[model samples]
Target: MKYLLVQEDEEGVERLWGRCAGVEGLFVDPVPPPRETLTLRGCSPEGPLSEILAEPGVSFRGLGDMCVEVWDEEEPVQWWTLVDAVVVAHQPHPGDPARYDVVIGAGVRNEESFFDVPATPRFELLAGTTVAAARAGRCSSVDGLFAPRADPDPVPLELIGCEATEPLLVGTQRPRRWAGAWADLLVLDRHGAVMASCSVDLAVSEARPSVLGYGLEDITLTDGGTDRPSPAARGIWTEWYQGPPAAPNGWAPYDAQGRTAWLELTTRAWRGRASGPDRTGGAYHLDGRFVTDVPGLHCAIAEALLGPGRYFGREWNAFKDCLSGGFGVAPPFTLTWHESDVARDALADVVEDPEGQLSYFEETVQLLERCGVTVVLR
Candidate 1:
């Protein structure tokens, strides 16, 4: 999909810098937890296993290949325990060609080591084999295998398949200054509604003239600690961006993270639309049927106060900020929480937070009462 890179001026107006035909490094998997060594004692050599054992210094380096499958009653139970790397130091059991002790080296086992296995697990080798060269349409791997380990320090976002709309050599050259480099990457759908967004410091680190005018190889990302949407969430966004829902509460079917992402997009769309008298004494109706989680509560409350596709807050701290003023309402307002029983049953248990441990539903009600909000439960 094409990505439009735009910079916002002091007045908050967006200016187009360039467009990218394709982007890299936008969707990244979370760094896998480090692996430890394990010993598979008395593993019998059977069928193809004997052939694999015959190879000297046998290793399983393919993605997800170096793993011990856990089974509980003839059915596989746990399979995600992956080995980042493995080297087999095979030692045959004397006089028993059927029995073999498999010594797996460092970074080869996960939380459930061989000691935790209840049954002899099958070793899978079906994980796709690695390639020596990068796949087509993408640049070669920097470290010879896979994209360079996500830099410990923030790496610049890569914009591949880039093309300049105008002559890059003749247009006003953007200086490499932080003041001039700050920009936002706004991902918009066909109808121009923002689906996802993140701010970046856009100083170009590398570029080259290509058949498509110019290619921007590297652009610095400066929004520290901001989480990118997961690949699944992006799929939902792909459709929502093209055509938003006709009414409110369209985010009901999503998982917790996806629901949170929907709130983010809706919040952006709601900006500059809030208008009303001081909301100190106004009453709002909260449809509490969907208030099953922290994010879900925010979604319900935001829609209650302002219409659909609005934002009251994201988290506890942000909620407090919204209660102060200008989030389409002020405190000392009345909130009629319909179907409050659903939330009570859902969020009855306390969960840990930076502030303190408290049930989300309980804390929300308490916080509202403390802030001069009269809550009516029904």
Candidate 2:
């Protein structure tokens, strides 16, 4: 099936954002139809299994995986749970060549965000998920699209029509900033092509507003506590998440404690001679080169790909150069930032000057693309 995410206005000039492929590696409880029984049935009392077996509805969950079995189906059925699961898809049925049949799935899990406040949280997928797919592209690993996690069953799904020229309404979402709230606008083409991507942020630096060009050396982030402006004049947050640095459970809150400074800003990019977004124009190629999740792997990837050229440690230019294929053996190569970054945006700016790193990344990514190398970091 093919899918696309787009942002269109009355002007009819649309933007292409990203694609979704059904390969997010998650097992979800598939909600059965209204009249159909989605839960497991025919339970008998065993000493310890009695309570579990007696429940009218059954959905089992675990640390990472979840599962459910239904023997009463037209055919026996099994389901697992997905996080931020695929909600809808356009599936092409066998013998049907001209039109696409939408393949939809039920959201089997019912877990609320530990925090009820909307859009402040993030998620992790065992395997990264693409919310939309390209034309004629295979939807791998994950099969059917799902409803929202909060809803156990599917709701009315409004999607763009299946025409490449039709503009669709992709969502307006926020990218995780190092601290506080910020968001970006993403626009995509009907066939899952990226048109234009942009964001709006506080743009503060050295007590001066980057966007408005005003200075606020005195104002700070204080929550009933005294403000302590620092090196760059931004105050350390007090009562950031309604409490101390850590939650009552003793775990560090995601937005607190300067943790975002250390977050790896991952990106997916290709740097090669003559390689197109379609992956054409070269015999020499390297693909799916994952920089493993291990201590110092960043340095390791830099050392391997850039040789003696510095990718990290020292300064920002070194990091940009290494990623842009300055030190790569390079004919053409596509590089991805692995899986974890998907849980949170890899581009939570940490540099006191937010765009210091942002602009360089943008510049380098565009330079690489113009040079026939494609880099993707969403």
Candidate 3:
């Protein structure tokens, strides 16, 4: 039987096949690593078939009556018992030219494991030791420290206090039994202009840890709708500092259900020196605002922004742009509005659709209303 030996490291293959003392017609081919290249060749089979089958990283499949074994270093072996059946009897599907009916079946089964798995949220450090280390000299540079690395343990910044607005659903869907969450982290100066912001989506289960890192600077979290707690609101601000003046703006319209779905915004501020010689000291800020209209969605946003267990540096460029152009523009608007349909589907489906395939704008709006959040244009 003809066999295909797909392997990554040549040494791994040598270690597996080296033990085979008597095997005829055995052949070996080199395959590149998946991250880099795909290099492998056909090898003749000569040793004990069961021993080969039991090989640590080798798997066998049958092509009709012929047996094909796949070997790899990083991946476990996948055996095919009916290789000939696939090669000769399988017909290609009309819609998918590269995939045959049997191949499609196998592929489908292979993908079952990933069907409900959530994509890892992209993480970004708004500020922290990582950033401080990187920007020790450059003025234009902004640095951030992240988790799940060999870096030294992070110093926990004092939570001093936090200001949070009532939760709001930014999407247009009703509350389903299950839902995903998301949030943004914004660093702002006392004037309320954003210095840096990181947005993240949380996982389905809260068991996962999600946190956004920022430089040691004075910062505060605020809702996207700008419905921040008034400094005079007693519990919202401390006596050491006076809060910003209340906005003269009126509240947005409530949703169909009479629930005012104001965007849930949270801000956390701190004091720290900016990076550079002169070490010109300034208050560093970090803000987390929920841009999406999906309700109960802050958790997902938080995970996407801070819980990836790895540092995804500068992944917030678009977020920064939106903040700058939408909310950071003159007078420093409290909130910026955009169509929530696309954003809604991205979170519910967990797969970002560039064409807005899963958008259910009206449905999401109703969902927000059910969550006691009112949808209003800024």
Query: How many pairs of residues collide in each model?
Result: 0, 27, 95
Clashing pairs in 1: none
- Rank list by lDDT: 1, 2, 3
In the range 254-334, model 1's lDDT, one tens digit per residue, is 766778777777766766344676466888899888877667888888888876767788776778998988776888889
Q: What digit string (tens of lDDT, one per residue) describes model 2 on residues 6-53?
A: 445469665543232211111122343232112111212121123322
lDDT of 3 by residue, 1-378 (tens): 011111124364311100111112111111111111111111111223223323454332321222222223232133222111211123334555442222201110010121221232111111111101010010111111111223222111111112212221111122232242434333343444332232322111111111322211111112121222222232222211233213211111222111111111222221121222221112211122332322223222222322311111221222233223222121121222234334444344221111223333333334333433334422
Question: What does candidate 2 score in Cα RMSD to the true structure?
Answer: 21.1
Alpha-carbon local distance difference test for all models: 0.56, 0.27, 0.22
Every candidate's CA RMSD: 14.8, 21.1, 28.0
Candidate 3 lDDT (Cα, 0 to 1): 0.22
Q: What's the lDDT for candidate 2?
A: 0.27
Model 3 poorest 10 in a row by lDDT: 130-139
Off by over 4 Å in 2: 1-81, 84-145, 148-198, 201-299, 307-327, 331-378
Q: Best TM-score goes to which candidate?
A: 1
